[model samples]
Target: MPGGLRHLGEGTAAALARELKEELGLDTDQLPEPPVLRWVQDQTTTRPGSTEPFERLHLIHTLNVPDSIRSRIATTEQDANDTTQVVWVPLAQAAALHLYPAIGSVLTTPAGTSIGPVELPPMVDGTYRWR
Candidate 1:
């Protein structure tokens, strides 16, 4: 999913739209509906070179990109960070990768189906589990 943190005073949809266009050459009109805020998670993390631990809130939203748009997507993506390969892995096979806000239970749902708006239990060892 094309994702990014919301800028100060910017709403979620705006941030996501910006990321999608910047990263995948897509726009907000391609979305089926307003993105769903599936869950909010807080994980304590240290910066790349810092020793200080800070709380980071991850707002996980589901972007329902239509098959038409998805089909036209390129095999690679770029962001402010760097260019990266886009691997299309089936949801059933996602368990093999380390996904943050760990898409734990939702991995079992059919692709394109949204997960929960439910509160997930606190993460164990900094890994977000959806159960």
Candidate 2:
């Protein structure tokens, strides 16, 4: 996932889609719509030496990779501001690994604020829901 300071006035899904387009150079139309949104709050010291509080909403989406283009993904830096390299991990393996302790806790409690946990409803069969 790409990480950077986000500008105000933009919604989370729009910001994530823009980031993917700018950072991966992939056609937005080819990407799947986000099915879930997970909000996280973080406090950090900025480059200008000021404490800043920010909320990150993780937009989760799955993409179907065609065999032809699979090997060519992640070949370039489409966004200059992007600082992290993207990697693809198999879903089954990812779920089996022991991730950071905080990662698991985030789903149970809101971070850095008093907000409560955001529960995502399960999807029903055959419906297109995009955010």
Candidate 3:
């Protein structure tokens, strides 16, 4: 669930593998294929008090991981001093939570509506602090 921007000339799959090692210390040898890009969000926003605008393109990947592996990775330390607490929320209740990029929109939609990529609206006012 934790990843970073790919290095110059580095493939997405390779970058993902490297990120897993740096973030959760997970080994990807067991996986048949690398995680695929699920969501791509392009956002432009100004930090709480900043007058200047910040623009970013975020890519999200999803993988089918074993429960044992998930548990182990969730407890491990991640990159960039990230202290994100991973919690599993049922889809039925996820819509009510504060999810970044408001992924709830997709989760709340009915199946078979879209087949390919989805674009999410920009994140609104919020404060971010990395621990």
- Candidate 3, overall lDDT? 0.66
For model 2, how does the per-residue alpha-carbon lDDT over 6-110 read when each residue is reduced to its tens digit?
469886566666776677665545645432344443222222343553223333433555645556656556666544565666655554544321233244332
Task: Give lDDT per model, in order.
Answer: 0.66, 0.45, 0.66
Pairs of colliding residues, candidate 3: none
For model 2, the stretches where C-alpha displacement exceeds 4 angstroms are: 32-35, 38-72, 80-84, 95-131
Supply every candidate's count of residue pairs whose N, Cα or C atoms clash at under 3 angstroms. 0, 0, 0
User: What is the C-alpha RMSD, rounded to one decimal, of candidate 1?
Assistant: 4.2
Give the per-residue lDDT digits (tens) of candidate 3, residues 1-131.
36577899998778888888887777776666557566677767676667787666777666667777767774645665657665666666887765655566566565446665566665544532212
The superposed Cα distance between candidate 2 and the true structure at residue 80, in angstroms, equals 5.1
For model 1, name the residue pairs that clash. Answer: none
Candidate 2's TM-score: 0.44
What ranking of all candidate models by TM-score puts the best one first?
Answer: 1, 3, 2
Q: After superposition, which runs of candidate 1 have C-alpha atoms over 4 Å from their true positions?
A: 47-49, 110-116, 123-131
Residue 21 local lDDT, model 1:
79
